[model samples]
Every structure is written in structure tokens, then in C-alpha cells.
Target: MWDIIKEIITYSLFLWIFLVLSYSNSNQGRILGCNGKSECPQRHRNSTINA
Candidate 1:
């Protein structure tokens, strides 16, 4: 009984987390233009181009 309850709790937690994450990401803009794989460079005005 304990094992079953634990399993159900685990599954519920996972489902809830997934739903929350999906909802949060809905209509959300790109994250840094990358999914934690590489750094995205932003457009910047170069002040020291010849330096």
C-alpha cells in the first residue's frame, strides 16, 4: 500500500510539474535564443571597432 501511494504521488508530482512548465512556456518568447546549449549574441553597437 505504501509503495502504491508513493508511486501515485510521484506520478502526480511529475504531471503537475509538466503542466506548470508547459503553461509557463506558453506564448513565452525564446529563452536567450537557445535552450541552454549555446550563448546567444545580442545586437550591440560597437564602440571600439578598431581597438
Candidate 2:
């Protein structure tokens, strides 16, 4: 009975750690756009023609 409880706790801790690491890694790509458009400044600049 005690072994089963210990196993459950160990698995829960591992799952929590895995979720935290994955969330932090993916957060780097998060960004915001101005003018209520989905375009980023870099992409918008590339699409415009000076002439």
C-alpha cells in the first residue's frame, strides 16, 4: 500500500516538472502585434515596396 502511494507521488512530481520545462521553452516564441494585425514588424517591412 505504501509503495503504491510513493509511486503515485513520484510520477506526479515528474509530470509537473515536465510540464514546467515544456511551457518555459515554448514561451520564447510568444509575441504581440500592433494595429490589431497579426503581422510582426519584420514581416510587414519585408512585404512593403519603397517604390
Candidate 3:
């Protein structure tokens, strides 16, 4: 019973770490957008031009 509890805790910690890492990596991409602008306006311009 103790072993099962330990295993669950370990798995939960790993999952939490994985989720945090993934979120940080995704956020970095958005944060480092075109010329370091988080809210790039080029995307909107291109879309409007295409439309």
C-alpha cells in the first residue's frame, strides 16, 4: 500500500514537471515572435491582404 502511494506521487510529480516544461516552451515561441514583439501585427496585415 505504501509502495502504491509512493508510485502515484512520483508519477504525479513527473507529469507536473512535463506540463510545466511544455507550457514554458510554447509560451517562449509566442513571446519571441517576429522581431521580439509578443503581439505581432504583421499577421493581421497579411490576413487582411489575403482576404
Best by lDDT: 3
Q: Please list the C-alpha lDDT of all candidates, in the order they appear.
A: 0.63, 0.65, 0.68
| Cand. 2 Cα-lDDT | 0.65
Instruction: Name the top TM-score candidate.
Output: 2
> Which pairs clash inside model 1?
none
Candidate 1, residues 4-49, lDDT tens digits: the string is 9999999999999999999887642355464322232442234334
Query: What are the runs in model 1 whose C-alpha is more than 4 Å off?
Result: 28-51
Q: Tell me the TM-score of each prediction against the true structure.
A: 0.52, 0.55, 0.54
Supply candidate 3's per-residue lDDT for 50. 37
Ranking by lDDT: 3, 2, 1
Query: Candidate 3 regions off by >4 Å?
Result: 27-51
Q: In candidate 2, what are the lDDT values of residues 1-51, reduced to their tens digit?
A: 999999999999999999999887763224443442335453346555432
Candidate 1 TM-score, true structure as reference: 0.52
Clashing pairs in 2: none
Between the candidate structures 2 and 3, which one is better when assessed by lDDT?
3
Q: After aligning candidate 2 to the native by TM-score, how far in Å is the CA of 46 from where it should be? A: 13
